[model samples]
Target: MHKTRIGRDGPNVSVLALGGASLGGVYQDVSQGEADAVVQAALDAGINLIDVAPYYGLTRAETALGAALKGVPRSDFVLMTKVGRYGDKTWNFSREATLRSLDESRARLGVDYIDVLQCHDIEHGDRRQLIEEALPTLRDLKGQGAIGRIGITGYDLSVLEDVATTEQVDTVMAYCTYSLQDRRLAGVAQRLGRSGVAVFNASPLGMGLLTSKGPPDWHPGHPSVWAAAAEAARRCEALGVDLSFVALQFALQTAAANGIVSTVVGMSKPSNLDRNIEALTTPIDPAVLTAVEAALAPVRDKGWDVLPGGGGKAGK
Candidate 1:
């Protein structure tokens, strides 16, 4: 396990962060006990950062994470969660709602204060209002010692750039935006890096497309999953490297990516955690990188109908 600096001047954190979305039951159905076990495994593996959101399984994920952190010392790990979206699928950035959301998250995670509190999925026009309303609330929370740092999570590079340039957010959790398949945020990462905002690259596997297993036909809501898998398969064949390993390594090796933050990919079994951990440590060759880029040229040229900020459309 390696550690990376969070913000330019922030605390050190594990190079790989455990994403709590899967623990809440979006990608695969996982029970509380199973989720807790997964969290425990991540901790044992020396992972320190865990990212979750209220939008994931409507707070179920946070609750499961809370249960998992019961015995762990608060100082040993960095806990992060998001506001903006509620369990009922509504986006609210009101002052009251933001404060209430933090309080609820603290209660659910059983933490005195969150290490990082982010605004979830803020986009185009919504960015200004969210900043105006939500950011002030978060700043107040930081003042009150309710959170250690502030952040915003979404796919919009411009908004993130604005936030990173203007605000004092310690981190930015940007998902599926700057993977090998999508490089829209490459410049954003550089800008934020210079600005001292830690950038956590989320969905590094493109939501399971870059794994060894080919994308299934029936994966709900994620049409790009299949396309990404096919592209990864072609790359694997050309590069003579396992697709899953390449995907994971590509993210880890990306110049703009500070660290890879992804859910414990458990579509099939628990052993997948070991496999992912192995991929993180495995060394990749330069020839393999060239082959992968060549194989992915077509998909890259096609340009996925990705959201402007890098998130897929709703129900995509």
Candidate 2:
């Protein structure tokens, strides 16, 4: 278990984070006991950060996480959850809504203060409203010690770019654009790093596309994702390094990626978790890194959208 700082100056967190989306039933159904076990396993493994959202399982994930952390000291780990619209659903960041959202999340997670409270999916037209009205309320909550820090999560670099300019935002949990396949977040990372804002690289595995199993084609949003991932895997095979290793290591190895937050790999069983943990521990050779870059060259040349920022969509 390796550790890294959340921001250039924020508190230290595990190099790998535990993404709570799976526990919330994004990929597959999970029992409450099973979700708690997953959280316990992550904690036992020294993972310090657990990120979840109200959008995931419609708040079920937070409830499960709260149950898992009940006996543990609050100071032992960092807990993060998001507020804002999710999917086709609409949510306003009105002061009342902000208060309600935080209260519900806090009550569900059984925490007095959240380690990180992010605005989820700022691409909605109501983003400006969140910044103007909702942010002040969030800051007020921060003043009253309701949350440790305020952050925002989104799939578009441009949205992040807008959020980065705001003074109220302390952290940004940008999506997969920062990974090896999609380097779109390179500029955003550099910019946010200079501004003293912490950046959490979510979807480092491109929603599991970079893994050994590759991306799935069952969802409407995953067509290009699967294609890009398949191409990368083929290239990795040609270059003689495990494709999954390439995907995992590529994101971890980036200099711009200082915190190296959890890549958020989903699992249907404990064995999958074991395999992912094993992959994290495996040392990636320098030669493999170089080869992965070479393997991605064709996709780079083809000019297909590789990152979420550049119109590379995510699966629903």
Residue 181's lDDT within candidate 1 is 65
After the best TM-score superposition of candidate 1, give how far the Cα of residue 164 lies from its true spot, in angstroms. 2.2
In terms of TM-score, the best-performing candidate is 1
**Against the true structure, candidate 2 has what lDDT?**
0.70
Q: By summed lDDT, which 10 consecutive residues of candidate 2 come out lowest?
A: 301-310
Runs off by more than 4 Å, candidate 2: 211-214, 218-225, 235-242, 255-273, 286-291, 301-316
Q: C-alpha displacement of 107 in model 2, angstroms? A: 1.5
RMSD of each: 3.7, 3.5
lDDT agreement with native, every candidate: 0.70, 0.70
lDDT of 2 at 152: 81
TM-score of 2: 0.85
TM-score of 1: 0.85
Per-residue lDDT for 19-114 in model 1, tens only? 888878877788877877777888788878888888788888888888888988888888889988774446888888898998899899998889
Off by over 4 Å in 1: 87-89, 212-231, 234-241, 255-270, 301-312
Worst 10 residues of 1 by lDDT: 260-269
